[model samples]
Target: MNPPVPLAKLLPVPKDLTGRLALAGGGLFLGQWFLGDLLHVPGGGLGVLLTGAGVWWLSRGSTPPRFQEPASLQGWIARCREVLDQFETLEPDGGVRRQQLDAVVQRSGPQRLALVCVDPATCPQQGELEQALAGAAPLTLSVARPLASAEGARTWPTVLQEQELILFSLAAPLLAEDLLWIQQLPEDQPTWLLVRSTAGESDRHCSESLLAQLPARWVDRVLVQRPDGLLRDVLQPLRRQLGAPIRNLQDTRQRLLRGLHQQWQADLEQVRRRRFQALQQRTQWIVAASVLASPLPSLDLLAVAVANGLMLREMGTLWGTDLQPDVLREAAGQLARAALAQGVVEWSSQMLLGLAKLDGGSWLVAGTMQAISAAYLTRVVGRSMADWLALNAGVDALDLERLKREAPVLVAKAAEQERLDWGGFMKQSQQWLLHATS
Candidate 1:
C-alpha cells in the first residue's frame, strides 16, 4: 500500500495573534483620544475604560496563531492521486487508468460537492466509478446509476456542467436534510448535495426539468450519479454561481484602475505647468542680462523677429507636442507681409503685432511651433543684450545689421526642416495681415 501523505506540510498556521490584538487595542485607544480627552468630556476616564473593554471584546475572538505546515499545490496533486489509488482498488481490471479520470471536490458552508466521472471511457468504468463515489469527501457513498436510464440521472447533469463550481461527495453518508440544504440554495450559489441511499432510483426527468426552471444566469453545470454507478451529463447551474462572483470582482478592479489612471494624469499636468512657468522665467532673466550688454540699433528687427518665429518649427520637431510647423510658418509669413506693406525693412515685435494680435499670444503661442521658436529667439536676444550691456552699454549697429540680413535665410531653413507648406503658409499669413490691419 502506498504510504499515507502527510497533512501537516499541506496546511500552515499563522502566528500574529499578539500584533493583531495590539492593533485592535490601538483602534479603541484612538477612539477614546478622539471622543473623550480631545473633547474634554466629563466621563473621559470612563471612555478610556470603555475603550479598553472594546479592545478586550475584540481580542476574545483572537486566538494565538499556530505554526502550521505549508499547504501547496502538491496537496491537490496528492488528493487526486489518492482518489485514483482508491479507484483501482475497487476494480482491478477496470478499463479506466489513473490518468484517464480526474476527481474534483469542494466543501463550503454546510454542503459537500464533488465530481467523479469517466474521462475517456469507451464503456463505463463501473467498478472504479463506484470507488470514486464511495471515496467522495465528507459524505458517504450514495448511489451510482446507469447513464441510459432516462428518468434516473437528471440531477447529475444539472450540476456538473458548471465549469467553475467544484463538488465533493463525501466519504460519509448524508441525511435528507443535507440534500435539502444544498437544494434550497439560490440557484446562483455553487453547491454540492450529498445523497445517502445507494439506490439507483432517481427522478431524472424531474431533476433535469427543474433545472430548466432555474434562472438562465444561475445555472453553470451539474452532475448526477446513482448509487448503483453511472455517468451523467455536465450540469449548468454550478458554473453560473462560480462565474458570478468573479465577474463582479473584475468590474470593481477595473473601476479602481481607471480612477488611478485619472489621478496620474492630473499629477502629470500639474508638473508640466510648473516646469513651463520656470522655463519662461529663466528665459526672461537671460534676455534682461543680454540687453544691458549690447543693444540692437539701425538693423531690421522685423526680419529678426520673423526668423525667431520660424525657429518654432525646429522646436516643434524636437518636442513631440503637436506644436504645428505650419502655424509658425504662417505667423512668420504674416510678419514678413506686414513689414513689406508698412515699408519697413526690419522685423520687430510691433511689426508682428501689426499683423497678428499678441493679447493671448503667450498662451496661444507658448506651446505652438511659432511660440517655441519665438521663445528661443527671446532667449538669444536676452543673452546678447546682457553681454552688450556688460561690455559697454553701447549699441552695435553692425551686429543688428547682420541679424536683419540673416533673418530671412534662417526662417526659410527652419520652415524647410519643419516640412511647412510654404505656399499655404504665405496665403494664411496674408489673410492674417489683412484681418490684423483692418
Candidate 2:
C-alpha cells in the first residue's frame, strides 16, 4: 500500500502566491549575489526571470499527457506472450536438475524423511535420532551425518532424493548463518523443524521464535526437545505423519516445484531493488550536474523530466515489463507534477539560505543550493518511480489514472524516506560545493 497521505491534500499548485514570492525572492537574491559586477544591476532582472520561471513551474506544474497503451492488437498479444515468458522464468525448477525433478516424480516406496541438524552438537549423536524414530514404522530416516559440513552437503542431496519430507534438527544455539543458508533451500518440500533450544521459554514458545526466520510451514511440524533428550510430541505427530495410510507422491513433486517458483520470485525482487538503488545514485548525480551548469531551476527540472523518461524505461527493462515508451513518459510527467508540488526547490532554497545566515557559512552559492535540491528531487522521483513499478508489476496494462492516484503517496513516501538520509546528502553536497566554488 502507498502512504496514507491524501491525494486531494497534495495539490499540484502552491496554496498561496506568498510561498512562491518568498522562494523566488530567495533565488533572486542568490542569483544577484553569485553574479556580481557592473552587470550586477541587470543581474537583478535576470534573477527575477529565473525566480519567476522556477516558482511558476514549481507551484503550477505540468506533466506529459497520458497515452493509450499498445499501438495495435498484435502489440497487445506480444505483451501477453512476454508476460508468459516472465512467468516461465519464475518456475521453481529453474537453474536446478530437471532430471532430478523427474526422478523425484518416478520413484515410490516407503515414505522417507531426510533429517538435518543446523546447529551441530555431539551430545545426542545418531543413536538418539534412531531411537526417536523407532516407533515410526514403514518409514526410512536418513540423518545427514555432520550436516552443513562439506562432506554432508555434498552427499546429503542424493540420499535426500528418496525422501518426501525433511526435518531440520537444530541441536545447539541458533546463529544468523542458519537463516541465510536455509533461504536457498526448496520451499515446497514437506518440512518439519526439530529444535533443541536452550532453557527459558516454553517448548512451543521457543519453537515459534526459533523458526521465525523460516517460513511459517516450518513451525507446523515442529518437534521441540525436552530436558530428557526426547521430542515433546504428545500427539506422536512424526509417527502418525510417516505411518499415514495414504500418500500423494506427485503432490510432493508439485510442492518441490512450487517452492522453487517462490524462491525465484524472492531472488528476482532482491536483484531488481539493488539495481534500482544504484541507478538512483547515478541519475541523481547526472541531474545535479545539469542543474548546477544551468542555474535556472525550471530548465534544470525540464532536464530532470527527460532523465525520468530514461530512468523509467530502464526500470521497465529491469522488471521484464512491456509498458509502452509513451506511457512511461506520461507516467514520468505525472510524477514530475507531484514532485514539484512537494516544493522541494523552495524548501531547499530556504534551508540553504538559512544556513548562510549563520556565522560560518561563507562559501554557499545560489547554484550550489539549486544543484543539491535538484539532486534531492531526482532521488525522490526515482524512488517513487521504483515503487510505482514494484506495485504494478505484471499488471495486464497501464492505467494512467491509477498512477496519478498513486502519485501523492509515492512522492510523499519518497520525500519522507530521503529526509532520513539528509545528513548524508548534506555531507556529499558540501564536498561538491567546496570543489565547485573553489
Candidate 3:
C-alpha cells in the first residue's frame, strides 16, 4: 500500500494582506529599518520599491508558481532517454559481467589495464577477473601479491612496474593502511580500484579512511558507491529531472500575469521567487533521500539530509521563490514513515556492527556529521547550523561532540559492559537536527 499522505503535510498558500493603510505604514517603516539600520544605507527608496513589489506580488497570488524547464516536450523526452541509457549500465546482472573485462575496456577506451593483487586466496574474484582481462586487446596487466616478509607490510612498487594503470579488487576488507599504500604508489597511470560499494551499501560504514585518502585529482570520477540496483534504470532520468529548474519559478511575473491577463513585470518577479523557493525545497529532499541506505540514528545520515535540504532552500531563495514550509515538513514525515515501515531498524543494527571496527574517539560522531553537513551547507547555512546547535543543544559551537559520543560505541567492549555515552550522543544529535532544519 502507498504510504498515507497527511493533509497537514501539504504546502500552504500565502495569506492575503489586510488593513491597507496600517500594513503599508508598517512595511514602509520596516523597509527603512532594513536599508538605514541593517544595510547601512541613506534612504529607504530601494527597500520600498523591493518591498512594495514583493507584497504586491504575494497579495495577488497565494502561492509561488511551479518551475519549468527551458526545453520543449520533445527535448525533455530526449534528455530523459539519454539518462536512462547511462543508468542501465550500472544495473546488477544487467548483461555487464565482471568476467567480461572487454566491456569495461571498450567503455573506458583502448587503454592498458592496471592490475593489483591482494593475494589470490584473499581476492574475491581473482580467477574470473584475470580471465576477463586476458582477452581484451591493447592492455598490459601486472600483478603483485602482498608480502608477508615484514610485520603488516605490503610492497607497493612491485605493482607499479610496467603497468600504466592500477586496479584493486581485493577480498580483504578495505582499510586505511591499504589506501595509504595505494596513495604512496606511483601515480603515472590513471587508477581504477574496484570494491564492493554500491549506492545501497553506503551506510554500511566500512572503511571511510579509504574514502578520505582518495587522491584529490580523481575525486570526481571515483565511484564512491554504486547506483541502486533496483533504481539504476531510473536513476539518470531522476537525476536530470531533479537538476532541471522549474520555469515558472524563474519568471513568476510572467506566470502570474498570464492568469490575470496583465503584463506587469513587477508581479511576475514575485511569482518567480515563490516558485523558486518551492523548487529548492524539493531538490533538497531528493538529494538527501537518494543517499540514504536504510536510515540510521547516526548524525552522519541526518547531516546529509539537512545539507541537501538547506541547499535546495537557498537555491530557491536566490531565485525569488518562496519555499513552502508545509511541503518540507510533509516530505520529511513521508520519509520517516517509509523508513519505519521498511524495517530500517534492522538495517541500522547491521550498520552499527560494521562501524564498530573503526578505532576512533569522542569526536568521531561530530566529525561525521560535519562532513555530511559540509556537503550540503554553504558558508551561510553551516554557520547557522553551528550557531543553532550551540544555542539550543548546549553543544560546542565547533561541532566536536560527535566523536565523544559515537566513538565509544565503536570501541571494543566486554559483553557485560553497558554503554553510557551512547544515549547522550543520540540526544545531542537529535537536538541539533531539530534546530538546524526546523
Candidate closest to the true structure, highest lDDT:
2
**Clashing residue pair totals per candidate (backbone < 3 A):** 79, 2, 29
Candidate whose TM-score is highest = 2
Instruction: Quote the positional error of residue 33 for candidate 1 in Å.
Output: 73
Off by over 4 Å in 2: 1-259, 295-298, 395-400, 435-438
For residues 252-347, what per-residue lDDT tens digits would candidate 1 score against the true structure? 233323332234334333443344334433443333223222132111123333334333443332221232344334333322322222222112
User: RMSD, model 3, all Cα superposed?
Assistant: 25.1
Deviation in angstroms for 189 in model 1?
Answer: 26
Write down the TM-score of every candidate: 0.19, 0.48, 0.22
Cα-lDDT of candidate 2: 0.60
Instruction: Point out the higher-scoring one by TM-score: 2 or 3.
Output: 2
TM-score: which is higher, 1 or 2?
A: 2
lDDT string, candidate 3, 347-382, tens digits: 333333345356454322423333322223222222
* lDDT digits (tens) for residues 81-197 of candidate 2: 444355455443363444443454455666677767655662245666666667666666676754454643422354453467777666435666565555645554566666666
